[model samples]
Target chain A: MLSDMQNNEFQTYGYTFKEVGLTPGEIARFLKVDPSEKEHPANVFIHEILNKLPDNKEITGGYRILPVDDLNVKEGRLACNNVELNPGRQVSTCLQKSEYIALFVCTAGDIFTGLTRRFNRRGDSLEAYITDAIGSLTVEKAMDGIQSQLEKAMKKRDLQITDRYSPGYCNWPVSEQKELFALLGETPVPVSLTGTCLMIPIKSISGVIGIGKEVRKSKYACAVCGDENCIYIKIIKK
Target chain B: MEDLLNKLHNCVEFGKTDINSPYPPDRKGQKGALEYTQELLEKGASPTNIMELALIPAMNKVGRKFSENKVFVPQMLLSAKAMNVSVHLLKPYFRTGELKRKGVFIIGTVFGDLHDIGKNLVAMMVEGAGWEVVDLGVDVKPEKFTEALRQHPGAVVGLSALLTTTMVNMKPVVDAIKAESPATKIIVGGAPLSSGYAFSIGADGYGKNPQENVLWLNAIGYAK
Candidate 1:
């Protein structure tokens, strides 16, 4: 693991696929399959894809810890050192206790999407579907590992961290990707955000975590959120 | 012929592709949907009967299982793969006009939204239910949908979006279609969407899952 010494600028975090260690059981929870069922095709497919995971040297993530300059609790708005954000009332409420906000971006990279396209073009949709699901799980697991590290670092300082929150979930507008990138600073994030706020690599994830002594994640907003499309909601269900 | 239809149903319901496929493990070496469909047709089984009795019912079961949590995406997709291949054998019958379709369904991912796996899954489910699906693909502008409706008059429209931000774009597309054809029914589905959202946007129905999309179409008189 390589991390930037915490500074005003973003720190690059790199990990091998093994470091993420996305297990069949973890992915199974999302897929609604019993990974313990050895002969189950989904379990079989998960293993097949796991064996093909990219080597450990791949750079998977980058994040920046931004000090919260101001908080407008009533309006559910906040300002970082350089950006003003209205991640909506739900997110604002969840993040209110933060003294610093960690903005992060991570990805499963081009290899997975490339394989998905190849399978789709061949009309092997089953293969494409399985591979795409794996890609989504991979990036998420990578981010989880990064978050764990963030938690550990904060722990040493006797500070705590909140659960992750991303744009387009829990009332956060995805167009805030531009604002998030601005927060990440001059070194461009490996993942590119489209004009529409859709990420270019399509498998990349960008989000925030609140770091403060009192900011403990009580429960996922997905429990009360209307966005059934959220992957975290799926995890919660699992 | 009844035995073959039963075999086809099990093949699709269980995700058995063909004799060479080894998905379900128990049905590893069995002749799957493709082989059974051919055999059924060879035995002079009516195409309409085969679909109503076999394909539609199998997919409906799969869809219900998906909704009930008895099955998941991979299983639904596996059934769709089996349904698609079997449906392929009936394509000639459809194109030649011997098999009449229920109606046309024009579907697309709303503008500024590039996600389409949900769109594609719903499209497959609708098609399996015996509707002629006209998929306009991802990032479709409002005009593209209007243009498709112009070509496919009396067709039902489906708008899909997977992002909370992009799901808002559904309103503009709905507004565009309703402006051109007041009577056109538009059904919307995607993970971020709800019936309330669909109602607010002037859509006729909201499909919580792909199976419900089929049910909505059926409820609106496009029965096969």
Candidate 2:
């Protein structure tokens, strides 16, 4: 059903589950939506994709992570507080292949398309627009699924996940996206990293989590990040 | 009536909702899509006709604009909001047989994929195109889709996944559905998915954006 161009774009623009060090079952758990049922659209889609998924070997070494504390945590140093202090634990996983490819799609399509469908129902733009607001409200709940899974995984590892942070979150610059990509061995997966650091095709994600042996209170929003919240109280605008 | 339709179209295209909505600065305080659509229906325009001539066409334009990159996510979302407002006014008609939807379209993010923005957009867009949309919400499993299909036998399905890691899981779900109900059509989308990925997984359709899906469905002779 997919066009040739669309198929090619998908191949280049997105990554497979194995490429990101995850299995279908693992992902299913994180999403909390099973694919075995016929009623779920996501399950149907996933079922189709898995049909052609290549069996890639598990890649052992691609990422090179240097703890923030080891990099530049000495006294009298130009301090950037975003750096993880005490340089918490580190863990990395990747596919068995030498490289991989990926993409980045946006959340915009859901809002627009969702609104159109709802409005058509009422034949009244007013009610549909209100529903649109309600629909957008679900974004938080959606992301919650991911956060909860990560939390569970961390707990199992006897580690505390300190605010699962993506590349562009807080002081983590977009430039750093390249670093993570390199660590993942982008060339093997054949992922194209765009100039602006956005993974093309709009579905890819790269992030880092500070895994600490101890559980500590964390500021939810970047604005109140504790490192500076106590001393300067300069809210890092989210 | 034509002027009102034009304004309504513009409101949806430019993301204007009503006097209170301020996102699209170009048309502030003007009666937006919400009011215009209601007015059109009140002034002897059939909801069906209004949907066809005004809402559908306007949304098609917005969808085309999105595909061509003329508008980004935020602007597209605005237009969607306007379209949604217009749809809400005509919902009851849809329920009582005053209107007939083209077909059923089911959509959701795949299991283990919680992101809903893309899936929701496709659901809305397909629904706008006059299809009876059954949204399964995010993190939907294969069995849920099959179950929903059992409930709505002839419905077309759309799958969405935001993560590359979870995209592969769509395969088994598709297989299960095809095994049980081979006649059901499936559309796969999301950032990580390409047309190749969709077909590789054996979906019946692929849409780059919500508008494309509408056009594709239209070409299948469902446009009204």
Q: List all candidate RMSDs to the true structure.
A: 3.2, 18.8
- Listed for every candidate in order, the interface RMSD values in angstroms are 2.1, 15.7
Task: Please list the residue runs of candidate 1 whose C-alpha ends up more than 4 Å from where it truly belongs after superposition.
Answer: A1-6, A37-39, A56-59, A219-228
Q: Candidate 1's residue-wise lDDT over A79-171, tens digit each?
A: 987588878778888887898888899877777778887777776776778788878887888888889888998898888999888887777
Q: What would the per-residue lDDT of candidate 1 be over residues B1-224, giving only the tens digit for each residue? A: 78888889999998887888787877778899999999999999999988999999999999888888788888898898988889999999998998978899999999998887888889888988888999998899999999999999999999999877789899999999999999999999887778998999899999988988989998895442
Instruction: List the TM values for chain B, per candidate.
Output: 0.96, 0.91
Tens-digit lDDT string for candidate 2 (B1-224): 88888888788888787777754555667788888987898898888887877887887787787778576444555677788788888898888888777888878787866556567667766776777788887668899999999999887888887655567778988998999998777788876568988999898788877877877777664432
Q: Candidate 2: lDDT of A88?
A: 16
Q: How many angstroms is residue B193 displaced in model 2 relative to the true structure, after the best TM-score fit? A: 2.4
**lDDT tens digits by residue: candidate 2, A132-197:** 332222222232344455457446746554444444334444455555554334333323455446
Model 2 chain B worst lDDT run, 10 consecutive residues? B69-78
TM-score of 1: 0.90
How does each model score on TM-score? 0.90, 0.52
